[model samples]
Target chain A: MIVERKSVDLGELQLDSGETIPSATIAYESYGELNEARSNAILIQHAFSGDAHAAGVSKKDGATGWWENMIGPGKAFDTDKYFVFCSNVLGGCSGTTGPGSTNPATGKPYGLGFPFVTVADMIRLQKGLVEHLGIEKLLSVSGGSMGGMQALQWAASYPEMCASVIPIASTHRHSAQQIAFNEVGRQAIMADPDFEDGNYYDGPGPGRGLSVARMIGHITYMSDDSMREKFGRRRRQMSDESSLFEVESYLRHRGGQFVGRFDANSYIAITKAMDTFDLSLGHASLGDVFEPFDGRFLVISFTSDWLYPSYQSQEIVRALRGRVKDVAYVELPSSYGHDAFLVEAGEQTEIVRGFLASTFKKLTPVGAAR
Target chain B: MASAVDTAVRADFVPEVLGRGDYQIIGEIVADGSSVLDLGCGEGELLAWLEAQRNCKARGVEISPTKVQKAVSRGLSVYQSDIDEGLADYPDQTFDYVVLSQTLQETLKPRDVLHEMVRVGKNAIIAFPNFGHWSARFSLLTTGRAPKTKHLPYEWFDTPNVHFVTIPDFEELVRRDGLTVQKSFFLRGDRRITYRPSLLADSAVFLISK
Candidate 1:
């Protein structure tokens, strides 16, 4: 049986420049047994728009998570052997405090009034949760895309805190192409006549705008080849007159489904944070940003993902290689585009399983500790 | 495996460098704690030697599957990749030293390979069989065939050496590219020669920085 628990609180977390934010509620879930050693705990970060329901049946939906394929008994991130922890990001909307959460000070939904949150702020909240759970060190950290960004930040900010880090399909910074896609999505949301300067809470506040934003986002998440293969000029089976183009039907399905769960203001807030994320900022250059990292890293990339191309992952490998030989890289052959990580179960599970075992060995009494 | 006394009948077998050349090439080029990318790293004998002797961490990029498997089996990380395709996959200056040992002559484009090697690595060490050796000259003039000796041992039809180069030829190529030759070594078997060895030497090794 899986033992699950959640801790939601408005804790005080001090920022980097000594600014303290009060009443920060973070929703998280933990599974399995926390051993007496507390060293077998593993931290799994969710990607952009993902919530704390990383594994198992969520109470909200009574359904499994996006990564349901490899997070069960005897699975890659097996709960039988290790305790796993996953939390909603600081700037997320799902069950956690975000733009949709009510502000204690003003007694109104934060909405557009929420202060800007960063990847560093997300890591800080994760640190508090880890500390709250009484875990001294993590066996491994695993994540993909925006989740990978958080994992990399954790490894760099607290190098000695984790035994190993596995970052998948992510770059040190958002590239020009990524920035352009995000900008288009944001524009789609803001251009709607119903947006009304982001005060969309009371009346029918830009549901169409939010759905359009999700449509653009879904398009970017898939590859051109996948789109051509899935929707190549074919019309919808039932609604021929309503949906003439096959691509339009696909986009409408995605956009319609997303409007049911996601909040538009949270979408704007999180994407803006991701756009401004630069792991190499504040440091002299790329080399200097990674100079202080002294840990084992496993960087994985997908071959078909043009959004965050394999070359970007190779840059991370190169930067780590500049300082240490413990870094390893693998670009998996996949045709699922940027979503390959969530779809290519066989290759993704193998790579992650190998990485987990190695990290476990490093922390266990069987081998040399890192 | 041929002993120095017995191998004379066959022409294609070139003896591997059993010991270090006199100048200690790996140590001279590698920094105190550097990562090396050894291209065409045959048998990984030199890389193992460098690691155990000098405490350097070495990874290899070899074309031959047999050599790459051998290197990995020896606990040295090596991958099979073609350098001629460009190092766009590898970020700039990922390695401190990139060594191409006696394999540059066989490449389709030597100068383009050099730029790629330098692009991926901070410094490059290239060693090749000197075509200006007296025996090679004598063989070309007297027998009208490509040279087949201890170092350059291949028939003209089957030789992998597409571009046979001498010390002066390589020097001219380097000078034209605005690259500097940091150090140079001329080898006759296992000893180093200080005198001009363009005519007498059987092979030459060079350390260049771009």
Candidate 2:
């Protein structure tokens, strides 16, 4: 279906770092109609590099949303049954107020001047958008990777806002290795001469550095087995100088593609946000963080996902075991590692569809809707 | 695959009768409106049956990821867990019934697992193949090898039943553990066998409480 982008002025967002954005505009897209009772509303959070266009053909780029396969009329999100909404997060470059957005204070782009945004901050902005839509309690909040972190934050920070939660291929906290990988990407961007201290909007920008950073990030997204299956010891055809390995060529292509669509500063800000994402940051334990959540939970993980592995999802499940009454967890076997949630949509669809169907049934009993 | 669809259609008509194998009998035994925790609940067949037939709140713990996925797809709350690790997360007598159906023989420490199940639930329902059945004894005598019947189909080398116990053996363990057998059902296929169950029954189902 042809979906259009909608924007809402969130006024001023008091960020977690004691910084404030004078005016923040959140770009969002919606599918289906919100029922009269507004009980069928579902909020889908996007991943690290993902945008507000979660489903359907994007109006701006004419490309499909990242989760297009799973959010259609009869798909997992099931637009026919539920009103699904996805918003570009705070510090996201996609139509949202981010590093690229013009700063009202200096009339220049925020760029490096943008204060760090945490997963909690992103959820707060999302809450504003949900409130703007006039939805009191969301039927569910779901997402993968950074989006999954946002989903967890929503369940923890605003426990009563959503009736159910689905956090797929994600973790409650970033591991030391996760932080190190993000650090490498950030250093790559900073090392770029053309970065111009994040004021390269009028210039060529950190194209090479951002491309390199994306390449590094891309490797972590895929498993060794998937990479091997896709391109083993095979060599790519190149002119005269030297032959390129198939995997090397693939990484280059992915990195080049990423640089054209994404902003460098926003990547830095978002990754930093993800690094600081610990559900039990100030709490005594993970159980204490999830104590307030009284919703059905579906925690999914991929077998080959070493970045945010199945063990990480198990940690969340372990914490929620006796704490939450209704929690379902599945570690789907997939060759595609951390990117399995994106790549393995067909398998995910069945699990998500069943979960949403059951959760909806519990929320709205037979004849209760009338 | 068509059979699965047929089963789904059949479930809509009469859910209690739709369950396959021992699950059908287990579904009948579980009380209506009760809370059940099915340990080693492969693909949650029994839990799903319990939910549909008895309108019970059913949760499952299965070790296999593939089976867990299948169970979740059926809209059952199934967790991927090894029962041998214990059920410390669940408080004492949290559930009305904790079921260890046809999985006791496969557990590394059957006694420890049973203890956890009994500790967590008001009552425990256990079902396992009777290794001392007449057919198994006959097969062992004739073939001069480990018995392989409908209930115990696997060969000794490939068998998952690491600690196989007969009806008499299980009853002995139950008595030794200070658990009272509230009810018991011995089956030869779908038919209930009561007289000389240790030699006649292929599988045994028991409802025990401490």
Candidate 3:
């Protein structure tokens, strides 16, 4: 299916940091039809560097969306039965207001002038777009990695608007190690002389810095087993100053490809938001954040994901179970590590499809079998 | 390797429409619209039945990845967890019934699991194959080897059942622990056994409360 990106102009977004943007435009995409009752709508959040074009061939680039395998006519999200929506986050550069967007006051790119955005702010803006689309309640909200964080924030902030949540290969908060990794990515960007303090949009920009950051990111996304199986000790033996080890070359290629598509400023802004996320930051306990939210939870983790380990997902399950809340969890078997949630869509499809169907049945029980 | 032959001979113990007879008994024991938690709920077959027929809100804890997938695919709230590691997090009396059907003997710490079940639910329904049956004892006496019966069909090396208990042994534990036995049902194959249940019955189900 060929899909086009749509935008909604939500004027004036007063952020949680006491900062206000005069005008905010959210770019999004949706599949399937919203029923008369509007209960079949499901909002799928995007991970870091992901855009609103979650599924289908984009009209602009004609490239397939990131999660195209998982959301289609008969796929996991099941567009035939669900009106699935994906929106670019508040601090994203994919047609959403971000650091690359023009500043209304100065008539120039906001760059360093862009207000800090949190994961909370991203979902808060998404809430406005959801309401504008006339969806009173979502059957479920789901995503992987950073996208999972947004789904969790939605359930925490607006439990009344969601029936269930499926947070896949993610954690409720960033550990010290997670924060450390983000710091390395941020430092790489700032160290580049060409960065020019986020004001390099009109110049060559910090392409090398961003590429290094992405190379580090790609390492964390894979497992030791996957690396050995895919690249082994093979050498590319390239003539240029390019990488020699096949794995190194692969990372360089991926990083080089990513530098052209993503903004360095958005990378800094989003990673900081992810590093700062803590569900129990203000609450008395992790259980306290879920005191008012009485929705079912499906928390999934990958067996080899050392970055977001299974133990972290266990903490969320343990907290919910301590409060006697309904929660289900599964540690999927995968050698792909954190990338399993994206590439191993077949394993996730059955559970997500069932979870959504049950959530819908719970909300609208008409004609459902006893 | 010859376990398939044993399984075939014990076809009476095989699953029926609602799964095993123990599941049907569990379905009867569970109250309508009540909450239930099944420990070691393999693919959540019983819980799904309870949800569909009794309108119960059912959840489960299973360790097998494939089984957990099957359960979740059926829209059952089954968490992938080791039972020995779980039940500690669940609040007191959270479920009306905590079912441990046909999985008690396989646990590493059966006694601790039993106590945790009682702690987490108002009632616990336990089902286990009776190792004190006449057929098993006869096999042991005649063959002079590790006895293998239809209900307990495995060689010693491959058997998952670590701690086997009979009806008498279980009742003694319950009595020593000061737990009230609400009900008990003994069975041989698919039929109920009432005469000298410990000696004649191949399996037993007990409902206990503290």
Candidate 4:
């Protein structure tokens, strides 16, 4: 129920090429009491297109959001024990200002005119929000997928701001295979006639193109085993009974559901941001990216997630172990693929609870160690 | 808890803290933070220290129930398993280091246990009192009986040193199996016998890699 919206001056968002977005607005939600010591505050970074409403049933549409499984009273990131914060990214559709929002200067949707944003840029904007909430050092920062990328960036960029980090089902950089997949999705949207070169804001915009794009994304989100188990070649019971393929039906349902809640412009912007997200892109190496992050780390990966496989998590742990053994990694056995972090409740809940308990034990006052 | 543990422990006990001969030999061996599976881990003292000081996690296979209890009480993790039956439950390369310490000479099937150790670990560390020491040679030659020293403090009938091996003899055996020696250390009392340990030392330690 506790939600808020605020626009902060991020100076000027100078694009990778040569452009500038004069201003930006960041939407965020905060819950639980921040302890007096200011160490119990946890920042929950939202994934691609995911809004600040990470928990609770939506007031507008009587439905729960993506991470509703674990961010409640007695959940893993328990609001009862720690302060929780989640915010819409720099370029997102849901409540925060994005390409679909009106430009204060021209009084029209920014569309493609919105400045290109990076994972680092998202972390920078979140820094403003965290400071606005009057929290100094975060007890821990955690998230999955795109959210996981932000957590990694937060720990790498602002090492002293948090005591620990838990990045689930994420990588330090986008692999060539992932970039190609996103590129095809973007191409699908642009090829649509309704796309209108990103200017069809008032009228029917690239819904079909965006739906197809989501279909491609949905395939990657789940594992083959998960799809086979959920929807086999069972006939949909009709006169002819020439039922659609199980995967076809499943993709159609997911695509329709996404199109209902999301904007095509937002998809273009967020996916582009993810494509640009390579933490080790310009850094000396993977190890150097984490050299500054001296805090304890709990990195988890799913056994079935071919996208951002366990090797990526291992790379992060290997880099950290080069410095110290404060890193703990647990590859949970699951068949849910990349989405396992959100769906595999039992495995994630146990690992996170155990990790937090251990981190808290280490971070407890020095006098308590004896 | 500390007082209760202290009261239960016997007082006359002074752990071998590795004499100079043992220390010099063990120092040359790789005792880093490896996944170690130690056989006949007495009191689990060395394993616990390795874990604490070297970040090496270890699992001990001890035959003595009393020693297993003592090791567990000291916060050292251990399992009661037999070595001769082969480490069938453990997969290949399950450990980086498999150590026999000073108990290899006492095993019923030393060769079988050594082969199993090599199979489970990439490398193995073995340490034993040298039966070829000058004192042992003198006793055998003059008294026509097995020699006893401070290091090998047991009578001929009760001694566990059945597989009596010397530095050169152990080297020959290790070479016969095509195993390469990573390092070797000779121990004489609390000092290292680096010059001619085969003839001068009381104990020898060798680190071997298959």
Clashes of each: 0, 0, 0, 5
- The first chain of model 1 has a TM-score of 0.94
Model 3, position A34: C-alpha lDDT score = 87
Q: TM-scores of the models, in the given order?
A: 0.71, 0.94, 0.95, 0.67
The regions of model 1 sitting more than 4 angstroms off are A1-5, A15-20, A239-243, A367-370, B1-210
Please say which candidate is ahead in TM-score: 3 or 4: 3
Computed on C-alphas against the true complex, the DockQ of each candidate is: 0.08, 0.57, 0.67, 0.05
* Ordering by DockQ: 3, 2, 1, 4
lDDT of 4 at A135: 82
Candidate 2 off by > 4 Å: A239-242, A368-370, B1-25
Superposition error at A136 for model 2 (Å): 1.3
Check candidate 4 and list the clashing pairs.
B20-B190, B20-B191, B21-B187, B21-B188, B25-B185
Candidate with top lDDT is 3
If both were scored by DockQ, which would come out higher, candidate 1 or candidate 4? 1
Best model number under DockQ:
3
Model 2 per-residue lDDT tens digits across residues A1-370? 8889999898999999999998989999999989888899999999999998998986666889889888989998999989999999899888899999999989999999998888899989889999999999999999999989999999998999999999999999999999999999999999999999999999999999999999998899999999999999899888886899998999899999999989999999999999999998888878888888888899999889999988899889888875636788888889999999998988789888888888888788788772
- Encode model 4's per-residue lDDT on A1-370: one tens digit a residue: 4334434554555555355566766777666677766777888877765788877666656566567787877777777877887888877886666788788789999898877777787787778778877888888899998888899999888998988888889988888988888888889889999999899887788888888998998888889899889877764653686777777877888888887778887888888888888887787767777777767677778889988898888677666644432555556678999889889876566556655654555566866532
* Candidate 3 residue-wise lDDT, A1-370, digit = tens: 9999999989899887899989999999999888878888989999998999999999998999899989999999999998998999988899889999999999999987899988988888899999999988888899999999998899899988888888988888999998988899989999999999999989999999999999999999999999999999998978785648899889999999999899999999999899988888988888888878888899999999988998988898898888888788889999998999899999899988887777778788687422
* lDDT, model 2: 0.88
